[model samples]
Target: MTTEANSKSEEGHDPFFDHVPERRGTHSLKWDKYQDPYVLPFWVADMDFRSPPEVIEAVKQAGAFGNFGYGKPSPKLVDTVIQRMQERYDWTIEPSWIVWLPGMVCAFNLALRTHGQPGDEVLSAVPVYPPFLTAPANFEQKLVKVPLILDGERWTLDFDALEEAVTARCKTLLFCHPHNPVGTVFTREELQRLADFCLRHDILVCSDEIHCEMILDEDSKHYPLASINPEIADRTITLMAPSKTFNLPGFGCSFAIISNSELRARYKKARAGIVPDPPAMGLTLAEVVYLHGEPWRKRLMNYLRSNRELAYERLNEMPGLQAFRNAATYLTWIDARKLEVENPCRFFEKHGVGLSDGSDFGTPGYLRLNLGCTRSLLEEGLDRMEAAVNSL
Candidate 1:
């Protein structure tokens, strides 16, 4: 038997995540960006784990058929998305509400372009993903950053501050569910307040929910901003993907769900000419992951829970550091202000680990650590972090 076949069908133990693939020469954005053999990159969000077995098998099957041409989304794909949403979130969605796209970042830019006129303002809470910071400027819209208050334990949205910052020129609130970096899954009450704020201001909400499926807390639930009610639904645009959940990001499939006909028409119009359809392989793998990857997803979450615990434990033990114990997402944020360091990102990189610089995410003196890698690598990165912070 071939070595590849052997890797797939090995007996006794699971073969999927047993080894980390050598990604140095693989054109990996995460690996290539650092360019140093010495740096253990925990900066970028992509997982070092292999794509789910179902995804691999489906892509291979599609490639073997050899009919890559102009394509349409499968009815199965739409129905599977509907079924999964209802089953998991108790949220109902119509097939007509789905608009497939190549990436969630595209959805952000589309939302801004479709909703914001020049000089109009777009608001997002700070310490967020980098794309959220830049998307507003891409279309000449004003960007407003409302800081998230750090409660004794977790990050909380300062709704009073958020409401005060809204002005007549503001057109949309670009919200993140299971927020990145800080990883707070906004509670139903928090989301309800957010919904009311938007509805009262008559502002449309574009919620990026890419990490919705990866909630770490078993008790916490992700409520789609639109799923709260019809009033919010008519003004909400939600973006989600299986890429983050099933480690299929490289396959490039994401979608925006817009329930309002006017909003959907605007989004589809903005997407024309510039946005291309997802690759044939992306569609095939997407369908497979949604329908058949749930068992693998459960395994991933259970394993990631351990990694998260190890990270939080280590960070809490160190002096001058307090890691946010997040309820969702594999990413966590740390406040390093107590360390009095000039640059925490560089300090960690100097110790042979790379992390997302907080300043880039609109919060200084804080860093975002990605916990989606192998347990061994997580140990190494954590060790480096401990040594680096201990030195200061």
Candidate 2:
């Protein structure tokens, strides 16, 4: 290892995340799920990298006190959340409008249950994160799936289909910002159109912006739909988390910024009996990350960009395989229909590689590869995957 790899400043972040922590025996869902040490698991969205040193130190400091009792979020944490939106996205909101949750997935589920009635319809684009498909059904609401059509080199929203699919019964849309699986960050114009569509139909928009900070493009940016306009803000319930950007998913701290008092009230009411506040440690870690994790997050963005480039290059080089570079997120979606494998997940697993089955994301014959790992680990997984494909 190089000196740069071993050295860590108290305030600076290392660019190369080549270190792989020993997670096999640590009860990690991502590492231990296969029950096979040989398998390189890339199925889950979580990364293998460590959280920011600042966060780790904060956690250690909190643990030293050794009193893990019930706690409330600090005013500083609330201010940090408010400051982040304004500094990063030029968006503004009050602390009163914010509702903290255990996780981003929980935020959307709670939103669905709060806003939708039984037999009502919820709209979402296909090939989305699994939660978008299951959350509506979990709350006795019907999900109306709209496909994101392929446009040349990238996947795009089919407004014609979206407009046609809207029905009177569809009162809510669980919108995935920068979309999962497909990984396309919707543009400002595109977001405006979505806002218009939802407003025209009087549908509540639950925009999930969990991956907003993991943009691979330096020029590209994540725009919260609610931040576009006041009316849109009133209709939108945006969910975001430091978990993805700072690698704190295990901490389970995420929050929803609902500018509209009515929607916030409904969400709070629905969550009253079920949803619990994030743990004290999560709150402390969130504050540390938000305040001191910027240097680490920037380095991570650079590292993730390289992984994206390598995956984009190698996957497209494979025979009968096609992949497009995404503007955001560390996930790359591969179109494996041309490969003609009956079950790509099983096929790759046989060769010691585990990828997310596209079927789980509403897109059959496709796979989502997580690029949030070391370059060498990613290369090894892809090499094994390619060797498997060649065997067929």
Q: Provide the TM-score for each candidate, comma-separated.
A: 0.94, 0.96
Poorest 10 consecutive residues of model 1 by lDDT? 5-14
Q: Candidate 2, 41: how far from true, in Å?
A: 0.4
What is residue 15's positional error in candidate 1, in angstroms? 6.7
Residues 164-229, candidate 2, lDDT per residue (tens digit)?
A: 999999999989888888889888998888888888999999999999988888777888899999
Per-candidate local distance difference test: 0.85, 0.86
Candidate 1, residues 208-325, lDDT tens digits: the string is: 9999999989989999988888999999999999889888888788999999999999999999999987877778788888888877787677767777888899998989888887
**Collision pairs in model 1:** none
Model 1 lDDT on a 0 to 1 scale: 0.85
lDDT at 38, model 2: 87
The candidate scoring highest on TM-score is: 2
Cα lDDT for residue 86, candidate 2: 93
Model 1 per-residue lDDT at 353: 86
